[model samples]
Target chain A: MATKIDEEQLMNDMLCRVKAVNNMPHDIRATLLDFKVDGYKVGKVRPGIAEMLCNMKTSVFELKQEDDSKKKSYLTLTSDAGTSSEERTKAVGTVMNQLRDEGFVKGWRDELFPVSENFYSPPVFLMERAAVTVLGVLEYGVHINGIVQESRQDEPKMWIGRRSATKSKFPGMLDHIVAGGQPSGISLIDNVVKECEEEAGIEESIVRAGVQSVGAISYENWDPKSDKLTRAVQFTYDLYLPPDFEPKPVDGEVQGFMLWTMDQVKESMAMDYADPIKPNCYVVIIDYLIRTGQISPDSNGFLDILRELRSGDCQ
Target chain B: MATKIDEEQLMNDMLCRVKAVNNMPHDIRATLLDFKVDGYKVGKVRPGIAEMLCNMKTSVFELKQEDDSKKKSYLTLTSDAGTSSEERTKAVGTVMNQLRDEGFVKGWRDELFPVSENFYSPPVFLMERAAVTVLGVLEYGVHINGIVQESRQDEPKMWIGRRSATKSKFPGMLDHIVAGGQPSGISLIDNVVKECEEEAGIEESIVRAGVQSVGAISYENWDPKSDKLTRAVQFTYDLYLPPDFEPKPVDGEVQGFMLWTMDQVKESMAMDYADPIKPNCYVVIIDYLIRTGQISPDSNGFLDILRELRSGDCQ
Candidate 1:
């Protein structure tokens, strides 16, 4: 009946509205436009837009303008039934509360800013970096912790989530569990410890003993919204575990967690993965672990950078 | 005064029209649309529309019901400004007569089509494969030949046309005459010698020694046209010559040609050359020569791919 809407088109339209409202200046217009274009959207939850809004809100607090001190929380109630009044109002209320508590939406009003949700559409065969983007964007704020299982006769193994098919943007996927959504500038080491306890049901003391090293992941993707596709930037961090660490799924979010040798991970990834987001994270994590002698990519033709990355062994 | 026309918008309009007219299939639509979005205008010529018309004509011919007896010609007419009408008509008649004599444009009158006069905007820079398409669509029937200048330490320097400032698509640029074009494939090797004679004004018996290699270059810029960009695929070959291969400017197409030592060419390209195109073409040629041991990239840090290709190298 209606034209099948595209994520890009929807974003372009929303950005045009923002421009119209602000009488958008050229430079600011470019940045906001970029965020909308490159931002991650899940139903009404746009991670990029949300991240920008959070940044803007934080900046407002820092500026300490006179108007900001007396900010009032804008709240509205909505039903969960098939009525706009209920669900929409509830969604706004949830955001308002989270923002006010986080100190971002002190004076923000509750308004129905219709968001066009984008579903995950991974490439037919995802490379490492692309896999990371898919996962990071889809599960923007989830925290995860995982263990690296090593054996003397074969490549090291790692335990991680077989993400819930219902919640997975990329269904039937498995990847390491690592911390996500700690406050932007907080120490990653602390966040990983907390994330392990919460995400994998491991205690902080156990996490402290198991935790190994911390490294970061960065990615670039073509974003048509900004008309500068190649320069779009996204980043992530990984938390590793020692050879003895074991993991158990703590909540409903994880469908199942698997203990996979490096070769198994590579082989399974090649078969099931279609985005670079998860593999990119694994590449960084595995590369770090292997380089440190915790694992080896070439032992069984698994963790080698040339094999895993260059030769597209996963594919 | 009319509003400034956005080249992107104009290209989009043209692409939409083409798609609608030909009922372009989905696969082709995606590729063509990608091109329209990424490309930019390279140049405009009086016979500018010839390229577009030729593409549209061929595609239409393909889409039409099967007609094996159909024939077509892609031709451009040029004459001195004061040529008589009869002479112009006679020229067209002679070409038509030749086509009939050759049996390439004879059987089906209704299906026989030629590139009649048409309007064309300058070639736009798309962020995709523009140059290759130009070769495929407009220059398909043309043949190309490659040649390399012999080491000329003992020969006299030559001059050809200075890079055409007004006529060149990429104005104020100079590039190596990598290959020369011919009307028929059979005479391509001869055309190489012919091009060296005309462009470099060298009459040496250029020998096609051996096939060195072939490579491709892809470059796209977002800020310039914000749409189209060019990707050039070059076929390079090495040629040998007598030690006394003297060179000089032989035609008006090129401003001047000169014989220079490797050091001199590098210095001229890096510091003395005034045209932008010359440097791009020179850099590639110099890099190739250096890698092949004909020159050096380290002497003055000039003509080095490592230096030139690194992000922010010039900056």
Candidate 2:
């Protein structure tokens, strides 16, 4: 029969067992311990660690000083901190220590934690189809349809689009038309057109026709190593102009209006591109018009001639 | 004194150890073993089995069969695999039986096996940079400076370009006019101008007088997991032209050639308009040129017709 281990002794014994089971060398074990403690102080642990510990065949509880008394609670290895290796290491230590010191190791052997279920395992043949993901952009234009005579103002005002409140990702800035991907026969163009109408409050079914322009942009953000700011096969399409293109701003998302010509709109876009005005909107719309020759290439073009002028040779 | 383990017994003991160490229950161990034996065997089996055995700390060696008196081999797990409960179960019947029958388990224990080195340690923070990995074509266009006489069919054609290959990731495409990227820069235009003359063998002293076009396109055959593709921001410029500009195409990468008008090149880009030509090469170049007004809109004003058609009210 094995000697009854005290909580601290049990924890130390389990740690030794963990090292042996994991086949980790002495140096590596020390490194892992240091890494775990430091990671715990800072929040950067993956939630998976808690699940891993919970599944281990050991019952562990942690004691914390509560006022004058010590309160006992089951130990879990989870932190809101970023999921870095250091954080993971700390979580492992905290859980192991709690369970060992509590003398719950034997109890854990009697209880079983939930095991993760396996999803579908596809064969290798479906690799190509599985790899493809789609990305796209819906381009709208502020057309100078006709000059409206303002009842109060002396100047002839051109009808312009109202500013959108949903500038970033919101009900409309970015919305998931479909939470999960459709299986087949999904036309990207039709989907984009539908999404714009739903999110941007575009009423008309003016699909951007013709192959006007194409290009790529890089996107990057920190956090979640597994997450990437990429959706391959992203396409941009300009909206078709409808005769009764009356746009009523969507409630809560879009705020009301501004009337400006091609020049004023361009200038506003130039002033502060990513301003409340949404500069990329202007770039996409202008590019479409220029390519179709609906608008003249404002002398120097959309790419600011003055800047290019400073640089030698156009090529 | 420790009991002497024969070859088969030694292998069986090791398999049992590995199972215990990995915490694989008996049911899972059975499943894994069955799967390894027959569930998947599309390609080479020996190497795959070797890889799996290596993970289990198993030693597979060649032995001489008594019947044939020729070299044969058997596999056995080492003592290092003993720490895991999961590994222990898997090794019980198969290799351990062989080791005991052969009576070579003691000799196997004496043989030194190489240990696996830890190459990948999880990093403290995953700091990764954004990579632009593909090129796209918006549109394609050509400009002509002077009229080509019918009699000058045999006249030596000229092409403007660099003599030697410039430094670029995609050296196979435009050898002299290399593509470069400036991740952090004031403007994409500024970076493009700097790269042009340096890579294309153009004189930097001459200023780019006008703004051309801003088009859009996207990439292809890019994989985020593999990170195999090279990406760079590209700025296409009109090799500064005068009123009486002549045709010229430099050798090496860009060989000498006569300049063609938009009409002559329209057919080539026709593939992009349709799906015949891959979208990137044709559509990207065409869209950029047309958006810039390098080639004026088609005579019929196809864009206007398209807009009118979309606007049902317009005649």
Candidate 3:
């Protein structure tokens, strides 16, 4: 018989991956460059940007001495540079170009992500999504998982995919059927449909008919490798597939797809408690499991899992 | 034309009531008496107890000198006292009796609540449920709401209760059909069934047949009146009632019951944004609304609500 899974251990493992960034060392905290327009914070530059600017001797920005002890010293654009959204976007673009030249940011993408006072508000400016993390700006992502259940089945199975080995992040790890960041200018539903077609070869008609928005999970963590404070909110969706349907990877991004019973999925999650599932994807799965009653209230660590899944808000 | 409900405002109202206690002032924090056994913290005493012990000249506990900067100074039992679960319980019982005599606790309850390292673990000891909040220990509550939906109805209605004005806490506020804290030794399902029968006069068989555990919501707050840091986790359940079924208030705790459409519930929640529903009941309803798709993912403040509902984790 398989050893019983320790619910507390599983929950701790999941939370360790998504721990919130509430306390930062003064040195690490000092390196962040806050970008403000009209006294409102819109974005931030990742740590080590001060050194880069010093080496380049850029006259585009200057550090403002912070009078408030609580506020970190931030770089402000020169008065000659306008503070309009377009002007600020252009200034950030120039900074990104300089950073790229210095080999800080790799393979820059043109796709823009929103910089808003709050996640639900309208964007003040659209910065390149690829560069937003390097800037330590909060980003939003959308993930849709196909819960394909056969007719008359008591327990529903799910369609899961493994990322292609060639993928830059979390290669060979398990992922949802369709997942992508919420780049600026694209509606969430439109993005979901596009991801479904490109990543899993699911027809647009099937996806549109079956997709249902379940909920979202938010988490903020300090990415050690990039030295950036990554704040993200993932909109989760459930697409119910018909019994005869199977997902095939059209794009090379997904290596393979498999339908696993809920038990098998639980076992996979248990077995890979250390590092198999993508960190954010693990949170989505845990949310789905708790919502669907696969993880009963009586289960140990059920409350802990519920609390940790939304650790982002605390930050 | 019906006015559009301000979703963001409604969510903010709900969140404000359940805001987690993040920072405690030193004066307030100094009052809590920690209870530990074998170096593991099991429970805590509320503020003002130090004065009571001092006035009473109690020899039960002595304040330990702090050596580690990170560790909070705590009150440990005198060396004469035993550290066994039974002995510690008895010792706390003496403290409770002394407190009751001094009017620190009112209306002593026989129902014992679990004292655990965390919400999910087995209890180290059982203390009176009514005194759990007064003791500043984390407590768990269960809330089962009856979702009575008519066949072919697009919007399902819920059975809601108005608490009796004569009741002590949250008197005359709107509440779920059935809700109660988890007392030691009682199973969750058993508590759900018992609460249904007592609170709503629902037959036990019907509840057992239709009740399903949906998910849970957690929140922590510092209760100023009790001068205690209160942490709570609510296990939510949905009981699908027949369309024609009506809940009758069998117990005097509830003044009356009414079935309202989902839109009406939303309107009530929006109208009484400040203090209409019982604070914890509002959280359960929000969870229900989001899960049922009544609160669409595209709705304003939807993600913020998701984040705030689980804010208890970071505490």
Candidate 4:
């Protein structure tokens, strides 16, 4: 017998996990300090992160509180860093290196991401990609859902990736067909073509013709250690594949690819509580299902789930 | 000559108009009171509405202020109203009738709308549909876009309706092919079918097969007078029509129907700023444009628009 599904619970659980701090009813986020760069409040970090940065004893960040309440505290880059983004980035980088040596930050990807208020805005500064999530920065990326449909009778089949076992993150877990962090210099569509080719062995011409940018799913996650806030905006897309197309794994980012019927995708996402797809990308699939008219509007918590999908600082 | 479009400005203006109190830099909502029923904050009303309700001195409401500042005041249903939803509804209904008589309310639809925190929940009370918006409540409705796309070379054409001049609200304005409020008994899909047949003379079989529940666009609008708050969740859908199918205005609700290509539709929505489509339905169209990928991922304020599309209390 197949396991029964509590779809509302599954969705609520996923949303709460993906946007832990946002789903709270009370102002529990007051415990977190506003993280400022060059005097502009851009992100947030836990009290522990504030203390850690302060203990580094650098003039980089000045942590202050209000009215005898630690709850009202904030950390801002000092005037010493000045207004030049380059100077601020270099100053922050020096502190980050010290943090790495002291074992406070890890997983250095060497890829740098610009920190900004929104995706298309000018950067406040640049930070190492891997450290972006760990240091509570707003990160943006693209995720696409590839599917095949000849007609309604066949029930459109969607393509999903299983991360390689040796991968550093989300290993052996299911994910979207093509996903990558947004680095400076490349256009979003061009980046989509590049990632599609590198991750799924899809041709550039096919990707350019097939892919369509839908929108975005933003989430605010409290890292497992509960000391960092990871805010992410996944720019979503939908790619209609030729019925006969098959995706072979090109790079080791993904272990393998499989085509799942709409039913199978729903089952994996809604019923696979034992292990779900990467929490953030999991929401993108639900969004795709909704857009394709698979998820009924009468489903309980439909409104809540739709809103929570973009629950973070969506801009 | 075609008018150049400032898509970002158009969307921002529509969103600001639809969700006025929401798109603020700070919480101007502090001016409004939490309208409570059965001790639950089910809605929010302008301070004027609160005072108007209490002025009657009917023992139905007891307004309280916090910190001697009106900022934190809430109007609650007195204990005399009891916990019986039916009794509370009857008591509130009596007041609604009186308010209508005194000209504080208008447009009695003779339709009843349930009061609850979210859809698919038991009612806290049932109020007249017309007063639901004037009195501040979360209203639910369904809107669908009907389109025909035979191939890639031909841009998809969508069917839109022009409201009859005789209608009281948004007369002669552009609207979706089929849209209706969610009543108490019918299923959402069934509501779509009923509205489709009644408004567009579409056959039941065709609507049942072609129409789909895509998702929702919720917005919070402060009425033109900036008094009442109208929080609405419009469940959206997409219906694929046969290439030859054309919608005829039925039941005198619509003046006529027009089929516009995607470019035409985008132009009407993005460029016709002097006289735009109905504000709430306008949001539904932007959502459709995004889902179909007509709006690029790199558009400025892409993230903000996506989030604000469902800017109301979605649940």
Candidate 5:
């Protein structure tokens, strides 16, 4: 006889993996700097990154005293209120590119993400996708669960992707069929359609017709080693795939795709489960189960996990 | 031009109805008393009601000093640690019945609700259903969305009921097909099965087979005039009904049942929409929409409303 799964604990474990602040030492946590722009908090950075920014001797950075007693200062973009988004973007980009040159930032994706209050809001500025993480900037992305349901009566099967081992971040980890960062230029739905075609080789027509914008999950990822205090919002969608539809790796982002049942997905979510799913992908999948009632109200950890799912700064 | 519905604003309006504390005056909010039992907080009460309990001069309650400057006191159930649930219930019942006789509490249901940490935990004690509201006790219930779907291709239609005008709470307001309080003795699924039979004329077998425990929504309702500071969790279920399955109102708790299209359901959730749905029912439906993708990630108020949906003390 096997022991029953404590999904609540499993979810908490998953939560701790992404929202790493929970397990971080107090000293490391204490040294985290708030990244602000035009008086709006957009992200955070580690003390080392903050110190580097403070020493930049450039008009783009300003270290302001946030607390006198703690001798703590916050790293703020010197972009003033009423500055044009373009100017703000250029100012931030110059500093970010400098950090990249100094080897302080890694995984330099030339892509840019809107630094805004939320997913749909106009960007206060756009920062390079890779540099954004190091600055602990709020990042937004779209993740689609490409699911196959033979009929409405049957349990839906999800298409999971294994990221390319050579890729920069979470490489070779299991991922969604179509998941991509919400770059500054594209609409959320457009990002979905683009990622669908690029990552999973799904046509835009099939995606437009089948994709349903489901919900969003927000979480803060405090990885001191990565210099990331990232608060992220993943706008989630579900696309019902035909039984014959199979996801293939179009871009090298994914190595392969496999369709798994709800139970199989849950099994993978277990902390000790083999062939690990990407940490945040686990968050998205858990949310999907909650919506579909596979992980339901009767479950011991339902409410606890539900609250923790949005445990990050959403805006 | 037809103005678009501000679902977020609409949700906020609905939330204000149930989580009444937001619109309450500073004085009233200040006078609110915490209700604790055996060192665990389980409910709250307004000062007038708090004073009444203090004057009752019964061993059932103790009015203890909390904040001297604010002259604030918390009303605690005097049931000691290690007290048997049976003894705790009897002692509290005496205070509750006395409060009922004095015209402080009304709508006596002769029903009891378990006072626990969450839905599944063993209750510290059982409380009278009606008095639970006055004490602002943590409440739990099950609400089922009865929907008619002709086929997988068609949008599901909800079986919405008009509450009986004679009902004590939310009289004549719109409600779910099957909704009921989680009584002390019944399992959640059993309560759903029972409510289905009594409210919708649905059989136990049909309910057992059909009810999918989707999720739960928690909210706080503070109505000063009503003397309610209720923090409630409604465990939600979605039951698919065949086209021929017309919900006949078995009990007079409902005036009538009408199957509404998804659009109609959304219209009813609007603050200005005619025939307002029950306040917390609005919370549940919004959640359902979020899950089903009717209220997508792009909705301006999506995250705002989602966060506010669980704006109550869930545990």
Candidate 6:
């Protein structure tokens, strides 16, 4: 007899495939041109950078010729002009400002993200948070999910929020109680506490007392639309709230909040074809389900889901 | 400042590197040649199969020439000889018996393992449990870990076992209270109960009542010594026991049992340089630590470890 493909299995398979795409190495060698400075690999430069740089006539950057190995030529910062990390940061910042002014990039928050070989190393240089992906550099984020179960109930329920319609990405989609990207300065715990209050209107005292660190999920994806490579590590947290406490949207990013039972959450997750939740959020929920023993090993594709959840590198 | 590498992070990094090795894809396209039965990809035959087939003078099997794609030539079964699944099973069984007789293979068991594209697919054929790895076919195993904790403790201690000195694999090494591969014909729950009795001498009533399905971890590794690709899916279970109950080894596989605190377990896992436990078994214990909130997100390499745990595909 042929094996039966159940709803849970189908959902799990879909998530796994998504993870594979995200975890697959960025073939910058094949797609974007490789940029190097002073014998060190800097980052990937998008193809469109040539025309943009030409239009801006930047003194700090130049388009270099392909080497004998036939690797694609790249737009690199002039080493004579900016040899030091500080000078390079300043030079790149100037180009980023020009790009932002020309309407080539959006959402300039003045926040900086480190461009590094791996997370556990000193960054080569810092770039604007908005332009990190545009430059195809690795970035990291933190996602704090609140598990608000009624004290009297036998089964726990999860608190979920809807992204505001005005949000630039994943607007009107379901999200965790609180989620945000990790910028250069703040620590993970501090970020979680800050996001809890700003995103969910949760009190600082409650968040500090109840929040527990769970784990993380990482994935690397190339966005063809933006011609960017996005390598992200999402640090996940579980915050338990009092049963009677209701969450209000303090920040405009969240539209509304709702508490759903496990069955309801699973049902939502099983709609793999639908965009009920943001893509990465789906993985975080699946990880929660597996860790909490809601997704049993006997379930179809349980192993597939577990293996896919950790497919990417954290560094 | 240079990025601070903490002990936890270092341990997590070590675990991730180990997982990467285990999870890396086997280029079946490169090392072992592929064998096709009818049109379906049946199995991977080792390079040595050519000489072995010639030595045995087998009528059912023949070595095919390499194709234009430059793919490796394979030792395939003659179509006219084994059309039906049963016939194919019998034909392969005959060759496997011959190989065993010739001392090319070892550890022959009457038990069968299903060879399939994925865990959910209808198996192409059944092979002797011990011979599955010899053929380099994708294999699935269930690893049911008994999480025995004392009822009286504030922070529960775990029941761990040391393998017998006479055991062939991982002799005198640490192991779960109960663990065994999923043999054919037995359901996961039934196998868990049986393994619990045989390995840990747990009562049937206690196992049936306390055993809970948790999740699974999948990894693919190429065994250089045997020149075989090992694809495994371990179905993990958590069998909670009362604090006072002691685990006695019924089967001689386990030499002794000990109850260790979380700190002790962490210390053992942190010993990345030593093979304190079987490699894959280390992953299972890490999963346990993460699930029980012993390994926090704040812990160094926590994210790396989480991602590595789920780095392979079961399907």
Comparison by lDDT, 2 against 5, better one: 5
Per-residue lDDT value at B144 in model 6: 58
Per-residue C-alpha lDDT of model 2 across residues B66-96, encoded as one tens digit per residue? 2334433223334533434344334432443
In angstroms, the error of model 5 at A61 is 4.1
For TM-score, candidate 3 versus 6, the one ahead is 3
Instruction: Calculate each model's fnat, 2 decimals.
Output: 0.00, 0.05, 0.59, 0.78, 0.53, 0.56
How far residue B272's Cα lies from its native spot in candidate 6, in Å, is 8.5
Residues A81-188 of candidate 1: C-alpha lDDT, one tens digit per residue = 113434433443444455457653333333222221221132111112222221122212323335453322234455667656665345546655644443322344
Assign candidate 5 its CAPRI class. Answer: acceptable
Candidate 4 lDDT, B1-315, residue by residue in tens: 346656786556545544543442235465767777655667877777788787785648778765454347888787777678888888888888887787767778888899886787788989898887655788889998988876433467888888888888888888788888999778899899889899999999988767777888777766646466777778898888888888888899998888877666666654335655666676787788888887787777666667666555534
Docking category of candidate 3: acceptable
TM-score of 1: 0.27
lDDT of 4 at B131: 84
Those runs of model 1 whose alpha carbons end farther than 4 Å from true positions after fitting are A1-154, A223-245, A271-315, B1-315
User: What are the RMSD figures for all models against the true structure?
Assistant: 20.5, 27.9, 4.4, 3.4, 4.5, 5.4
Candidate 5 per-residue lDDT over residues A177-287, each given as its tens digit: 988887766678888888899988999888887878777777766674656666677888989888898888888989999988776776676566678888778778777
State the weakest 10-residue window (summed lDDT) of model 4 chain B: B17-26
Residue A33 Cα positional deviation in candidate 6, in Å, after optimal superposition:
5.2
Which 10-residue window of candidate 1 chain A scores lowest in summed lDDT?
A306-315
Kindly give the stretch of ten consecutive residues in candidate 6 chain A with the minimal lDDT sum.
A1-10
| Steric clash pairs (candidate 5) | B18-B221, B19-B220, B20-B222
TM-score of chain A of each: 0.42, 0.32, 0.82, 0.87, 0.84, 0.79
Could you tell which candidate, 2 or 5, scores higher by DockQ?
5
Top candidate, metric DockQ = 4
Give the i-RMS of model 5 in Å: 2.4
How do the residues B114-172 of candidate 6 rate in per-residue lDDT, one tens digit apiece? 76655665666777876766666766666656565543124657778889998766789
